[model samples]
Target chain A: MQKTALTRRTLLLPAVVILLGLSIFPLLFSLALSFGDWGLGRGIPYEWRGLSNYAALLADGRYRNAAFNTVLYVVVTVSIQYVLGLALAWGLFLRPPGGRIFRVLFIFPMMLAPVAVGYMWRLMFQSRIGAANFFLAALGFEPVRWLSARWFAMSVVMMAEIWQWTPFMFLFLYAALMNVPTSPIDAALVDGASRFQVFRHIVLPMLMPISIAVIMLRAVEAVKILDTVYVITHGGPGNTTESLTMYGYNVGLQYFNLGYAAAIAYTLLLVVVAIAIPVIIFFKKEVSYT
Target chain B: MIRLNSVQRWSLFVALVLWAIIVIFPLYWMVTTTFKLRADIYAGPALIPWVDFVPTLEHWARVVARYQQVTRAMANSAVAGLASAAAATFIGGMAGYGLTRFQYKLGFLRNRDIAFWILSNRVLPPIVLVLPIFIMFRTAGLVDSRAGLAIVYTMFNLPIAAWLMLEYFKQIPIDLDESAKVDGATYMQILTRIALPLARPGIIATFLVCLMFAWNEFIYALILTFSRAQTLPLVVAGQATQHGPQWWDIAVMATITIAPLLLVTILLGNRLIAGLTAGWGQ
Candidate 1:
């Protein structure tokens, strides 16, 4: 019979190969491209421009707007999603009538295409001929142009994100809630502590690790947001809701400026990595706790 | 334990139901709007379907007939998602087997490092590498093709699959594989016939989870394809702005995209939950 070591190596190599090919190769390729000035049209050729691309993004109004929008959207949406998600998790744990079916219902949005979700909202948010405005008029408020105005359009985009991702937070927080030791909660209850006190003093503290994990994870993901916003407003009104990825797409694919686009994409990666490192550390601690 | 009073319990129930309805209304709105006519969907503050208007299948039929890419894109997404997930699961299962069943030492890095290295791939966002991958695909003539997209998704999903399967493999007792080996079964045979079969539920969960991700993917498909290899999500995104999106039609398209996920949710509820907590929920 053949040795197990050989079998293990053979078995493991494909995954290693595919992972490296996908990640490291593109990482290096993008890293190299980021340092050059390359474009297709107007007879522009690949020329060395060390740090120029990164430096240029500093003063670009559009890039700054995208950066600001990305930060604003992530902060607003992640905070709303976390609060709602935790409350929903607590609600689910309470097991109200018909709660089981709702668990299934809640996750459907998170699973559907973000693009599809965006399209549904886009239809709903249509200015004159849409259901959202129809309700606004019914409520005695004037019909507002949701996607035509920068603030409203961005709000609409964030709404789509919050609507879709809150379920994700719910599922994770709910799972963590299940894992929390019941001993502390039971002791708090037997001590005649109030419901809010029991939760705040014991349960919430117990859930802190998971809360941090979930928040950090979702925060990292929020920074990478693209598909939904792309469909909802296409970074529109005046680049108000534009994200780093959207801008990169426009520059790289639409504008055919590969080098600068690569730089933009690299910046996105760096920003995400900065946030993700702490998350990685948290999970590592979680591993030891478990 | 303190008993919740009727008033408290009832209020809690109401609050829970309200929360769930708020969560579920968009999907309900999508379905109801699909059945409503263009004028009705456009004109309405009506949230309820039966009370709002009579439903019709005209838009549903038109979604198929009008957008020729509707069916094609769905099929493309299926192929890409299913194929990549299957590949990822198979390869990842083997890798998981390697990680769980055997030990290896490499220079300066151990097996744990390799596993985490794979895990690290999952953390990077799709758009970061889309440009470089697009350039590579362009040079290799692989862009806008199903195989190329599947390959991308395979890499996209393989890490999670491996991580998940590694956990699954640990749960399964190693004695069975050891016994099978004692009976002269080869490593491949034991893996195929023993470990894999025992972990079938986890594998299925992993496959469905990966399939959900690849199928729902938008940006990669957007950048990598023009019209030929567009996935359903890409198609929906593209057609949403075309000719002033017919809400009814968009709803129909949206429904088609959501239906499979709903089925997966219903059929594999526990597995789906497991996959979500398995980390990298999308």
Candidate 2:
């Protein structure tokens, strides 16, 4: 028993120590920093601000806009990704001709670095000499500025995000679809059920658990959307497309407002926790039931 | 699997083809743009390599010429990504084996709680940790060092590694451990010899996933490293200059940045997909 205990400790110790030092320690430090004022760029020493940074965050319009934009981006991108991803996954699940090649090709976007994807999309949407505008002109429509406007810029960023991540959803859902038992569906089909009806009644419920899991995964990651936005828009012609992380980045790194940045970071943390906890609990319950 | 009628089959094919076009176009554009001259790149929709514009190796040649920064960055990324991934996989694999094969109670925390706690670390945005980590790294004088970047990446990748390895280890029969123990093999021996070997594919998948993230990681590389340990993503991002982004140069650099992993994905695409979705399936 003692030997087993010793072995367990030995096995677990490294991971625990690393997480403590790198993950938990930094979070604690950031939490403390959030309540202080440390503008390194301004040559100001650290000073206890006592919630002033949080107060500032609450009243900051740009911060609010960023928060809204982030939520909007997450919702829009994840939703679109889910729909498109499910459709593609269903298509692949059907075993179409050349499906193997299509499956490999589909995952290429997801494999590229988000920054590269951002740059690729940025080039495609460049105002004057862009492929988007060129195509528009060819279609006998006037070239519309893609990046300069608010919604358009947000849409472009979200488009890139969806294009990149839908493959992730497809992979997950397709994998789940493959795992789904076919007997019930076969029985349903023999009972003269329509394909749509059989999918809705039989397959959808079976896919529910994995579906929730995938969506939760994607949604949580979407909250950290920064690299693509940073490369493509840099928070845009205005701060319209700035995400929570981007705002935190600006405050922390670019502006050197460490305390305020920490506050923003903490706020983002709260948002992520809020989004994650319920789904986690629900998943736990689902697992228990199964 | 649903049997598709001819109409359904054709529609699915067309849809897949259309989506495939959307998926492949950006990559196509990136690769094609790499061969185009500066004038051709900015000269609206010079897509077809030879027909639309005369192809040139100028950008690739220039990038090859500037191999000092590019190669160093690539080397940094490779070292950091591989180091962190290897470290995370080993450590996380151990933790995973421990959780699966042992029953533990840390006060109110059980194995499940501990596992969830580790996995919850994934939900923490890098933005929140960046400042504190920056300070920590600066204080330790690890700023702009490959070791520092690797250490951080190891930590961030640990949750996924541990979680995925947990799932993988679970799939391995615990009876193997029991039988090995009865044969007078130590727990360490059982793990190293039996479990690790059995879980080799999972470990490889975990390592690859960790490597992918660490390799392509941008924000931490942006903040922590200045010059000495700047990764490829940082190098690619640095292409944006005072005189507008050097699109041709960026295309070249971006291609180089993404090419290695692109090859990995093509080769191990199915393995990656399976490994990625493995944990999520209860």
Candidate 3:
């Protein structure tokens, strides 16, 4: 293969154009659209409504509920996945025979589409004829309505999110765990350290960076997740499962309040960025260290 | 080391087996529900396929013989997936190769900045971007078109594709490029012939990932296409929705929607995870 002379000018322009249209354009346009009174009305007559959409959405009870749900969802789901994933990773790190199969199975849920996952669990969580309630009633306990109430609806959403994503944490944590130089672990074991102690001191510190990054990534994905909630709850039981993204979509697409939705979308962006910036910084630091 | 006694070993084995069952339970439920009658499905979550329960091909038959839109959506998804994979592989691959291999004397601030911008853009939520994209597509008269969806998907797929390919390309020492240059070959020739061949695994990994992203994408498909260019996820998801018809048919279609992905994941799960986490930690 012969490499002909190529100048920087030849390659840079197309990349710029792709990134511009994809990333730059949407970002700027969305920001601009947030400020205008664009909706389902005949064409967007540019009426600069400065902070009205934001103020209105903030005052709206629905947006506040969605915001609260989003924060709660992120904290609970991330915490569960992180803890469960680390436990699973440590279990697998023991490297008993057939460990590889278990590892693959652990990460299996991550591969399916979120919508499929939502449906699969929706069937499981079915109160009347669903498996979960069936088992509950079999044990002589009352079968609770999983999707019929606000708290149970949120619980079901959390359950599905955990089921789907714990595997992601397992995968990343396992990857980082695998890369942890085995000598240190072995040394701790030889020095009469228990597995738990080794994990607390030697392993957790080493895995903290990847764990942080994983939390950041999972949190971002969980925040924007619409397909699961869209399928499972449809933000239902009186807007109990309505995340910020779902709320934004409802205002924009369902209600045709484009400007209000745009503002909502921008606010969601800020929330995500607030989470993202730290992760990005952590990621850059991790990258530089390596 | 608490020396694992036989009892401990046996207990560990039991725990592993139990967890394995839990992990695979959902997948098993999905597949089995496809063959079950509606009554059997609603009848207390039978772990074993019911012996007396009649296994009817009705759901499959209904989906195949009756539903034409699903078939059309499947086709749209395939077209969108393959087109985006090819476009992303070619353009993003070239961009990946250029960013990794090409060095200008002045150092390309523009090039590095473009790469950074692409990464940041990937993090931008599609909901935030969909309206702007919708407006743009409507203005261009490309709304509700397959190509429109493809363009949007291509944009999302490109960043990771480029980043993936860049990492893969960087591993192929510049010696190849230098040697190719010594042979007085064109840069395009080196890329297409040498770098591309050496990076075949990387390309396939990237292709599978991009195709998966395209095939399974929902939000953009939901927003961009109403009836004309909707994807499999949109169709299945829409069908299963509370407002839509034939809830059991959703089980059928969800089965169908997940089958291809299941096959791909089971076959290429390792490569998929590796490709996804390539630069995340290391």
Candidate with top TM-score is 2
Interface RMSD of 3: 2.7
Clashing residue pairs in candidate 3 are A2-B185, A3-B185, A4-B185, A4-B186, A4-B187
Decide which is better by DockQ, 1 or 2.
Answer: 2
Q: Residues B1-282, candidate 2, lDDT per residue (tens digit)?
A: 468889989988998999999998888888898898878876778877678999899989988897578889989999999999999999999889888888878789888888888888888999888888998898899999999999999999999999889988988888888899899998778878998899999999999999999988999999999899999888877674222457778878888989988999899887887787885554
Choose 1 or 2, whichever is better by lDDT.
Answer: 2
lDDT of each: 0.83, 0.87, 0.79
User: Lowest-scoring 10 consecutive residues by lDDT in candidate 1 chain B?
Assistant: B273-282
Q: Show model 3 residue runs off by greater than 4 Å.
A: A1-7, A288-290, B1-10, B50-52, B104-113, B242-245
Give the chain B TM-score achieved by candidate 1.
0.92
Candidate 1: interface RMSD equals: 3.1
Query: Per-residue lDDT for B46-161 in model 3, tens only?
Result: 76754636577778888898889889988998999999888887677877777777553335544455555556677888889998888888889888889998888888888888
Sorted on lDDT, highest at the top, how do the candidates line up? 2, 1, 3
Question: What tens digits encode model 3's per-residue C-alpha lDDT throughout A83-113?
Answer: 9889888777776558777776777777677
Off by over 4 Å in 1: A41-45, A288-290, B1-3, B175-186, B278-282
By TM-score, the better pick of 1 and 2 is: 2
Q: Pick the candidate with the highest lDDT.
A: 2
> Which candidate comes out best when scored by DockQ?
2
